[model samples]
Target chain A: MCKKPLIDLHDDKLFITFEGELTLYTIANIEKALAYVKTYSFNALQLDFQDVTFLDTAGALFIYNLEKYFTKKEIAVTLLLEDTTQKDTLNLIKENMKSSHKSVPRKQKSFLEQTGELFYNYYIGLLSFLHFFGKLFTTNLRYITSLKNIRFKEIAFEINESAIRALGIIALTSFLIGLVVAYQSAYQLKIYGANIFIVDMLGISIFRELAPLITAIVIAGRSGSAYAAQIGAMKITQELDAMKTMGFEPFAFLVLPRIIALVITMPILIFVADMMAMLGGLIVANIDLNITMELFMDRFSEVIAAKHFYVGIVKGPFFAFLIAAIGIYRGLKVKDDTQSIGFNTTKSVVESIFAVIVCDAVFSIAFTNLGI
Target chain B: MEFIKVRDVRTVLGDKIVHDGLNLTINEGEIYGLLGPSGCGKTTLLREMVLLQEFTSGSIELLGKRLETISERDAQSLRHQWGVLFQFGALFSSLTLKENVALPLIEYTELSEKMIDEIVRFKINLVGLKTEDANLYPSEISGGMRKKAGLARALAMDPKLLFLDEPTSGLDPISAREFDSLILKLRDMLGLTIVMVSHDLQSIYDTLDKVAIIDNKKIIYEGTLQEVTNVKNDFIESFFGKMK
Candidate 1:
């Protein structure tokens, strides 16, 4: 039942009475009445609880706080609890409040202890990641040996969703990047009458770095977030729980398709990216330097060797594996709240981007050592 | 004084007219039930009262203040004067039960942390939940417990009027009866004026002092439960005659 808890000023004393539940449900009404009472001057305030059918800790705390407030303002507040149960409940809550407050300090961890806890959690996180990697590696090896058991349709759909759908964005961004690079370089190269060298720069940069890095970054943002969010939702809704109970492996059904799809498609997406980038460079070369498409192609083929293209494509599957693994890991980390899905998704994106860059750096070192 | 006065209320949602020329009055300290079949706009009426839903044409008053024509600040201030228990406990999943109850106090009041903690502990307990439940998130608790926690959240502001949207639908029979008695006790003790949307015949009969039933987007019957039962009509016959 909802009734406004009210207060009346009578005989220089304010009398507060609750006509409804004093719980959080009706707290606003009680607060409204208190706000009204606070405006007027009174010698004392009294609370009448004879009509109060229910009295709990919340109601008791309200009275106690009201009492403390009035006392601070040089006004005396009295509580009238005619019901024995109401009085007992109030007293019990008052006692428990003190005890609960006291328990806080005893339970609170020390500064060093809290620091140790932070480190301990990170340690556990690293171990969990290693364990996840081991399980995924073993599962993939097992599934690969029995390749006939894999779901090709699901893999095709994943490729369509994660990789094929991403081609548009990748093409657009890479073309623009190539155009920007060629335009910026043409001006500097033209100053030294070395405009023809722009082809060599575009070819090396786009093939050996830009195409692979841009494609990986784009896919990480697109498909990585989706994988994390999808799995996270499944986790929160307990669909993953249901799958586990039914003896369905989430790794094989969910993770495997996504990974297989990304692995197969990443290189194709990179190859497309390379074509778009070179086309953008070729257009800029023709427009800015008066170089014909034939001349541009001839110079590009001479300047950019096949090894540069090979270096970019070679990094695709590794980048794909890293992105998929990070997304799947973050998704699994999502706990009870929908908030965790958001948090994990963002973390997955950031982590995958970092991992991709780190992988690219390693590739750069290895390729340089081999003189590719 | 008339606590709630609705005049010439008209509402149309999407392609359907939910209510037309609807009028109702709710007096102070009277437990009123809005009863109807599913999709009859029982909950819609409650939402309109709380200003969550807007009507096409109507003048609605709460605590002698016009609801439709109020300043945004005044409207927000007015929200503090009443409580709403949603069909499901819409407790913030990120916040624990205690934090959920304390949210309003923290938002609206300048009470000390100690006071809020005490109140949070007390409200959850009043609803028959233990102190341990305070640390538990909504998902961690049972459906019935979540309902109670929702009620606790609604009560956090100590609203005069409690708006309930089928408070007993998902509970077990015993729990439903317990919830009913809890409402009755709150009514008797605090003199609460309750407006609830309910399909449960037992809840309507047990807890409501007055009732209004809607059918075909109109109030088919408006009276005490006994009076409605006495009125012989096809819908009434089909409605109450079968509940027994």
Candidate 2:
């Protein structure tokens, strides 16, 4: 039940009467009515608002923009206001419109500029990670000297979360890997009447490389991302700041417990994974190579050296340290946004898994060079 | 002119009965305040009004459409008719203030980018935020600025009805008063029917034209502050007693 503005053109002058609420909802209809006025030749435009019931910011802005449009065409304009309140609104909107004209839109970056920014961000990230690592190292050293400074309860909770809960998935994945490796080797060994060689292949690969690598990768995805997300969320909600205010170093309180728990549980988890893998290989050998379980165990103990087990288990702590450190480092790097938590969690997983594989490669080269 | 009418709304959140037989009417062009004690489901009622929460029974007629049975298309169109400002300024953390304000316009309308930019600048200025603040993310700004940015985004579509949840809670006295005045000015200029949930007494007294005090799972009083002050209720007595 709103009346459209009446437009009448007489000689060189134009008269317009506005009625009802001249707000955002009605402004569109007013625009359609005025669309015909642009075709007429008028030197002076008179906007009569004596009967207008209401005028909002958008309405005021529309009138202001209409005046500007006519004035740019060298046509003069006059506004007849019925109320002081409407006049005040129009003036308020007019003032804001003038100030808003100064705001520049964000500029687009060129390809080179974007590339340069990417490189610069990576450099800064590297430096920050190094600083975080140094702080973590020194905090661990200082806290390790004092037994009471460590939070044993929190460490236990973390172990339950990262290690104990992860057993089922790790067991399944390691068993499957062991079965596939033994089956593949047995196929080729049986061709040469060397089906017993499957034991040597399964033992060396599953114990020295596959078990440790798979376990680290799984833990990296599971516990590493959890660490980053937990710490990052805490940072976002300012809980880290709260801890700092209460004289608790976040490194000692949040990061150390996670790192210690992961380190202690990692070797133990890897050892279980190694045993499960050997059992899987034993089954495969018994099934495909006609070797009995007792016979396979006898050959396995004779051939599989203790050094292979040591090499795989030794890398467990290093992989754990890398995953936990990267996770915490990424978590601390989270800025004041929820999206940063997601981004950092993803980065934590990717970086930790990458670091684990690279460290494994280095270990392989070193052990090979030393004739281990 | 009746923008919203809640009739016998019964809300049960889990086993806890949040509201029973709640009824209120919000007329057009009035700053209506929903005042209550803590844990009285004031925010819950606001959420229910905005369609973020559901009621067990009865009807909430917003803009003449019953909320419980409103179709998806009707709900979508009705949503475009009102703007909601959450308590914590619920701004997108990733986007800058300008982009945050422009999101609704970009998603709903076919306006040109240049036009959207102009409208964004106007809204940012209208809310008393500096032009330079447009480039900064929500996390970079203070609580007051974030609320202002949120208000700006809420107003971007130039909606007829506005809903504000505790708009002055986290602000300093000066900023809070400024916010109250801004609310008054926006209502006057835009002809907006505002439904605000507020615990701030000063804000309620300064800005509200009418108020509905909810206590004990139902509205204890619904009228002007002067009339509400005369009501014989423990909550009303303690709430307004602080005015002394």
lDDT of 1 by residue, A297-336 (tens): 8887887889889999999999999999999999999987
Q: lDDT by residue for model 2 over B1-244, one digit each (tens)?
A: 8889999999998699989999999999999999989999998898888776789999999999999998856776877778888777767675799988897787678999999999999999999999999999988999999999989988988999898999999999999999999999999999999999998889999999999999999999998888887888999999998785
Each prediction's total of clashing residue pairs, residues at least 3 apart in sequence or on different chains, is: 28, 0
Q: What's the true lDDT of residue A65 in model 1?
A: 72
Query: What DockQ does model 2 achieve?
Result: 0.01
Q: Residue A287, candidate 1: how far off, in angstroms?
A: 1.3
- Chain B TM-score by candidate, in order shown: 0.96, 0.99
DockQ of 1: 0.01
How big is the positional error of residue A47 in model 1, measured in Å on the Cα after superposition? 8.7
Give candidate 2 misplaced runs (Cα > 4 Å).
A1-41, A46-56, A79-88, A99-101, A107-113, A182-195, A284-291, B1-244
TM-score for all models, in order of appearance = 0.52, 0.56
